[model samples]
Target chain A: MVKEQIKPMTSRERVLAGLRREPVDRTPVCNPTSVATVELMDLVDAHFPEANRNPEMMARLAATGYTEIGFDSIMPVFSIIQESSALGCKMQWEQKDNWPTVRMREPIWRDVEDVVIPNDFLTHPDTACVIECIKILKKEYGDDVAIIGKTMGPWTLGYHCFGVEPFLLMSLDDPGKTKLALERMKEATIQFGMAQIEAGADALTVPDHATGDLVSGEYYDRYLKDMHAEFVDLLPVPLILHICGRTVDRMNSIAETGIAAFHFDSKNKPQESMDIIEDRISLVGNINNPETLYAKGPDAVRDEVCANLDAGVHMVGPECAIPLQTAIENLTAIPNAVKEWHSRRESH
Target chain B: MADLQDISNEKIRQEIEEFVENPDEIERNIETFARVRPLMQEIAAALIEGDDGTVDALTKQALEDKIDALEIMDDGLIAAMGVVGIKFRDNYIFVPEVLACARAMKAGMAYIEPILSASGVEPLATVIMGMVKGDLHDIGKNLCIMMLRGSGFNVVDLGVDTSDDEFIDAVEEHSAPILGMSALLTTTMPNMGKTIEAFIDADMRDDVKIMVGGAPVTQEFADDMGADAYGKDALECVAVAKGFLSVQA
Candidate 1:
């Protein structure tokens, strides 16, 4: 079958079109999560702890996804602990080579009533940095590329504020209380999401860590599906829900959420994930980070990019946050392979 | 699902029969629960359902009824977890479900441990487990600990972000012959090899059998790290520990 000739899209048009499941010249190489590596940080002189807390540095480091690696989108929220930091969880700001994490053992909230979005939640330095980074990227890139901002979903915040064990135990011990806790915590997500949108984010990745390894699909249905749908209505920009690990079980429910897309994990086969979502929501993902990108070479990376394209994944990128030391060549290979795949398809 | 309160032995056996769609897949020793006394089967069912209260209360009742603690543990709690492990490995359940089952197993173990210890029988074997240094993720390690304990191994859970010194100290302190290390990040994964090298430097490499696991760990990575075995999940963690114990025996 001969394919019609297609025109090339600007990064912004390509990414937004892919998210909307609209036809694009080719699949956009997008990382809704962090593509910030120690190498990228060094190149930009914007290492973490500072890159995570300073807007200019954050933007500089994040810009490499577009500038250096050539992904269609630049995502600045490199760490998931921003809202948690703003909301009072103690932050373990690690060195340049490590991703910062919330110190969950020192949980800040004990119950639903204690789930407070601090007075300066959005204005807090860490959270503010994300918004400021988005603003900077928007001013700099404008319509040339899609600037994707991230807001932590409440389930993930529950782990940060309440402690992973305490929050999970609460969910198992009392589903009703877990529901109420997530309901209250979701305000932080909305508040942060709206701030990013106001700062000129074209899309927001609502990363709820209902990871397939840790939480059941049934738990997702009970706690997060409705909340995510509410996020679509509440957050102004295109919403891409990112959940890590094998998530095919919840793809149907995730598809029904009316979100713009789901950034999937490498554990899920791209074709099977496509068959499950069935174009209900566009899929953006799922190149293996640890094995393929972090450990292997560009050839292995291309193989995954081809797999995602073959499966009709709407966009293609690393599964989650790429490791801090991931090779530059391996990272760049994503967009290169996507373009090559498109060119080959057109030639056929 | 049948009402959890319907705790009769026959009903519990029927529940196990129902919960375990493929009985043949369970270990041969665990499959013997099918022929055990009804109360034991009921205990197994409560544990499988993750009803810690039911498992705890029924375990005490089984003790009061003079059932052997070992019999209760082997045929009841461990048997139930055997099914839970298979279900988890097969993707019929997930972390939350496995965690719930582990909690129930712990509750039943709380009643069984003292009696088993008093009976003067040595633990099945001693194993030390921890998440490698710089990696704080322990959900996988904790799950393996729970499954190891449930499967009759005395597990020394060194917890998350454990350094090589901590691992060596725990092994030396506990005199554990088997060591299990877990890491969730590729960056911290090399620390497992570092820990093994530390063991070699300390001249304790042959003193313990080493197993490695976590989301990012592959058999190739395990071999590269000089680990004796690599478990893909909590179930495989238990199986590897069992294999280590059998080899030592």
Candidate 2:
């Protein structure tokens, strides 16, 4: 544990301990989501949308989170559409300047009966790319740092496969049908998550995307709370639940989830989120992605890091994927702030 | 006697509050609807209920009964949409609910658009809106368009991956005074500045007011690009466009 450390801790040990809500030498500098940037891609010669499909480029690019940005964890999966791609959702593999997104306009499945997990779901290029990247990172940096992996939760999968408008309409119009579709779709989340763990991920970021923009807190409790609790039970390793937007309304329900940590957004204040969660789960993230990391300088980034540290947030990083154009100085500011924070306290 | 006297007011309160959860929004909506005629109030209620077919039928009925088109537009469609916008901003509802309300408002507007055009009733303002180049996310842009059209702005959508030249030409063609840019990616946000630069190069920057928005956009970034205003979301975009026109007027 960090409080009684006789020797210095490894990045991976610090992160795992933080997830367990155990003592840490300091708050771990980590992001369970994408920290990929256009500059980082240029540094590694690993640009997207190719890097998203190619395992070698993916691993190389992900390693920079450690070697370059000084994050305690390396997350290879940047976009949320890998498993959706494997599941045969229409894809728009955008240029290097844009994120590759699911062609949500062209939905694949409509009815609960139409939900199908392919027999070769794990072997398809997109899903398999993630697995291969994890294997490479584990072989290389597994001992040194945590290789975080991503798997789309069923609610997000429902959006990708069923289209956003149609899926939400289904949820609103027919509760039973929507629940059945989510039930049928959850296997894909589990299979892909397990495959990455088998390939040696120390933790998994299961991005459910029960976004606060569309879904209500009541809907989150009604639809995803039990499912997320089940995911914690099924996925053996440490689990992180990521939901975007102003999700403070669902914090109580989220705390009910047996997840190891909640990868929260910057919209929620860190101290308030810690109060709501009250040690039910570890908290990760909440540095503003758009303004602070992408547009502002290192000083702004440092201020955000210090706020999360002050709030006793377990891990600190960008609220979501860093915009591909984020400056290296802003990305590097994270760990530097954490180190400075600990040293300043010790001096006091 | 007091209880009986407040009965009608209380009913209107409960009815509007049924759709609107926020207290401030309900009071504002109640005040806006108070002067509206009963037939127009019926139309507003249907629009707020997201009953597109009912809005369609009732709007057509109001038209046949020789009610003024602008009155229906303002008291019925626009007033209800104001409530929808407030509810959305307050998290009382979200994208799907707003989409439904926009659809209902559209149904009512369909009957009014032809009449308004024939009578030469001017739009609030002509605003040009588009997603910046390389940013394909359209949910935010489409939502803004819906709210703009509902709020009586004549919006010319330039669609996703909009080039600076496209923006420049649209302004010249439409003689539009307001230009709005949206980008959902950080990599593409700089393109907002680039488009503004294109306007400057074309010597048309002063002719049109510029507003920028999306998930990743901010007021500081908008200021950096020398934009006239920045909106955080769809409803706010309507307010920004209105502000631009109000300033122009």
Candidate 3:
């Protein structure tokens, strides 16, 4: 039994309390998404390009998300290249300051017939590193700060695996072939997801780019709805479904998928997004990353935090994986704003 | 075989249209590619042969047949993407299709760049672009550069992890009026503000309009940082650049 009059203690405590939907003394400033900071890059000696691929370095930088920056969770494997890299796509490892990207000039799976998830997929160095990082975090932090693991959704992986152009062509040319490719990619999603869960991750962020960008809400309903629902059912832990870009159009269906929470983007306003998906799901965001978190000062970060708290978001965070260069002062101010808001509310 | 010849031109035309409306179709249907290859080769031959009227008629027929402008880049692929961008903004198309069209446009652009440069057509604006200091994320930056180039801006890409001095010097050398800064991380985003402050301290604020973007940026933050604009993404950056130039006019 919990007392209604209890006040929030710390960000860690506030987040755990919120996981149960219990009334916290204040809002929690947990980034269930990536919180890569430059300080961490130097601290770990594993910067971008390498951290974007190598598991050991990936874990080190991810650890800074919790140990160094005071974020409530550590998210390893920052980029979305695992499935594509494993699927044999050519990657351009630009340099330290740039995250590695799939070179789309030559897509791996030229045709639907060529698409297949590798058998030794789990043992792949990058995939193995993500699982290892989660396991290591679980061992180190135990249950103190949640360890959020990322497994690219099959659709997103499909974008990199077959090259965006080839995949889109298959989607239009032969719908069945596109379905075939997605079906194969799902094995990678499920296998990686289960591995992370087994590796001691408290939660898993299933990032499927089901934005209104390339695919329609109808596409999500038709392809991902059932798979996501099943993932939630089988995973046996909180699943945070993160989709980039404006996704308000699919709030109804996303809520219906039984995900514990939806990590949203700034493209959708916090109040409007909350109004749309409040009761159906636990809303986690609406902070404008580019304008507020990335470009402004701590003052602006605090303002956005208070606004999100006012909008009744179950959790407040950056709209997405925060850029590596975001000011630490802006991020550290998140917890402070939540605390001030609660204190003001209590006094009133 | 007789029907193949009877409808060869029509078949090539239809294939070209599918290639235009959906660039993905060009990769999937090998037969369509084979059929169109000869016609495209003939058009290239005609262009080489100096048969202007024949090339014009074939190009128009190809377009009517639904030839993607990208496939006919020596023809006018930019016009096709312009159509795609309009359709995209109007909600008639989606991201994947737009991406496909962009790819097609890129392919065509590759073929046309040298020729276009030789024609002495000046770009609308000269823009300096880069990912801000301490941030390595470049998707948003690259996309903006592509869009800027597509929209007729002479883009000087400074690559990722650029320091304030690098930006100031680039502006000095290129005489660029717009400095587009991007940061994908919250930590790096503040660098945008710092960079803008550098420009101001150098008394270059009046000379350049600073535009900031990436996942974490907002318009309010841009205003707070004294940046001229905050583009939500690459597309918005184009509109902002165009608007800024218009204001100059």
Candidate 4:
């Protein structure tokens, strides 16, 4: 059978096409998570603690994903703690080489009734920087590349707001209250997602840490499935859901969420994840960040990239955020391998 | 095959039937379950189901019913956690389920600990556990602590973001023979190695066995850092602790 040859797409077009499950010239290297590293930060003089706060530095560091590494998408929101920081959780804004984290020991809210999205939530420096950064990327790239924005899901917000032990314990001790808390917290997700969309983000990465290691597939169905479907309807842009660890157990439920795609972790096999999604939604990744991208060389990175391509992953990127110390060569090899694999496929 | 009716306890029989209906491919430590008495099996089944209230009640009833504290621990809590460990490793269950099981195990342990300690019977081993410096994630370490305690080890938990000196001081204070470190981020994984180097510099390298685990840790990384062992999950953490104890013996 003769397959039709498609024309190459612009970075924005390529990523959108891949998300829509349409044909592309090659697989788009889309990192819905951060690819910012210590080396890249030094290259652009945009380090964390500041990049996390300043829009100019955030956009500059994120642009390296496209300009330096040749990925089709640029993700500016590096830390998951931005929304939490704005919500009043104590944040440890680490050095250039470290990831900023929320101090879970100091939880801000005790009950679902206490959950309140401050009037200044959108105008907060940390949250506003993401919107402003997306605006800057749109000005510079202007439809040439896809600018991806992130909004922490309610489950992640629960971790930041109530602390991990208290939240999980609440989920186990009293599911009704947990649902109410997630229901109330979801408003924050929708507001931030809409703000980024208005700020010119083409897509949104919704990272809810219902990681397979921490939460069960049943919990995904019970708590998050409806909310995720709601996000697709409420948010204007395409939504990519990201979860870490072996999530094959919940892939079936995730497929029914009406999301545009799922950014999977390396703990899951690429072929298995592809099969589970069954083309219902695009699968963006299953790359090993710690092993292949951080510890091993480019050759190992190429092998994983090829594996995802062969598995028919809609886009290729790291499993989660790449380690801050990950080499530039390993990050560059992702797009290079995608191009080479497409060329080889075409030749055959 | 044993008859379901002949198994005596309905809950234990139901649990076995459930496993029989959908069997896991991983080889379980069935010897522990097989050696458990019928009452202990019921306790084990409740623990596996994560019925903490039931575990708490059953453990108390067993103690009052004249069951040996050590017998109830080995035959009930530890045995149940063994099934959970394999289920988790093989992906039959996940973190929420495991946490439930660990909580139930703790419910059972609360009644057993004081009794076992008062009898002057030695613990399986004294171990120190913590999250490496700069890493705040401790869910994995907490799970390991639960499993270690269930398996009869006395663990000194140093909590999250523990510095090298904190780890060294914990081991010294407890006079612990084993140390287990956890880190969720690759950025902080080197802290495990740094903690090991600190031990060496303090001339305490040979005094304690070091083990490392977490999402980012691999056997190769553990070996590179000169760790005595690497556990892939909470169940493996218990096994590694036992291996250290056997070597010391």
Number of the top candidate by lDDT?
Answer: 4
Clashing pairs in 2: A38-A324
Ranking by lDDT: 4, 2, 1, 3
How high is the DockQ of candidate 2? Answer: 0.52
Best TM-score among the predictions, by candidate number: 1
- In model 4, pairs of residues that clash are none
Ten contiguous residues minimizing lDDT sum, candidate 1 chain B? B1-10
The per-model DockQ list reads 0.50, 0.52, 0.26, 0.53
Per-model fnat list: 0.40, 0.49, 0.49, 0.47
Model 3: per-residue Cα lDDT over A101-188, one tens digit each:
6766456777667778788788887778788877877787755777778888878887777765566656755777777777777878
Model 2 agreement with the true structure over B64-182: per-residue lDDT tens digits: 99999999998888887887777787777877777777778889988899999999988888889998887766778888898888788899999878899999999999999999999
Candidate 4, position A208, lDDT: 97
| Model 1: lDDT of residue A58 | 93
Candidate 4 is graded, for docking, as: medium
Per-residue lDDT over B33-119 for candidate 1, one digit per residue giving the tens place of the 0 to 100 score: 546777888888788788899999999999999999999998898877887887788777777777788888989989899998898
Instruction: Tell me the deviation in Å of residue A327 in model 3.
Output: 2.5
Candidate 2 Cα errors over 4 Å, as ranges? B1-12, B15-28, B118-120, B247-249
RMSD of 4: 2.9
Docking quality band of candidate 3, CAPRI definitions: acceptable
Count of clashes in candidate 3 = 30
Per-model CA lDDT versus the true structure? 0.87, 0.87, 0.71, 0.88
Off by over 4 Å in 4: A1-5, B1-7, B20-39, B64-68, B247-249
Against the true structure, candidate 2 reaches a TM-score of 0.93
- Candidate 2 per-residue lDDT, tens place, A85-133, comes to 9999989898886789887878999899999999999999999999999
Q: How far is candidate 2 from the true structure (C-alpha RMSD, Å)?
A: 2.9
TM-score, predicted candidate 3 vs. hidden true structure: 0.70
Cα displacement (angstroms), candidate 2, residue A321, comes to 0.9
TM-score of each: 0.94, 0.93, 0.70, 0.93
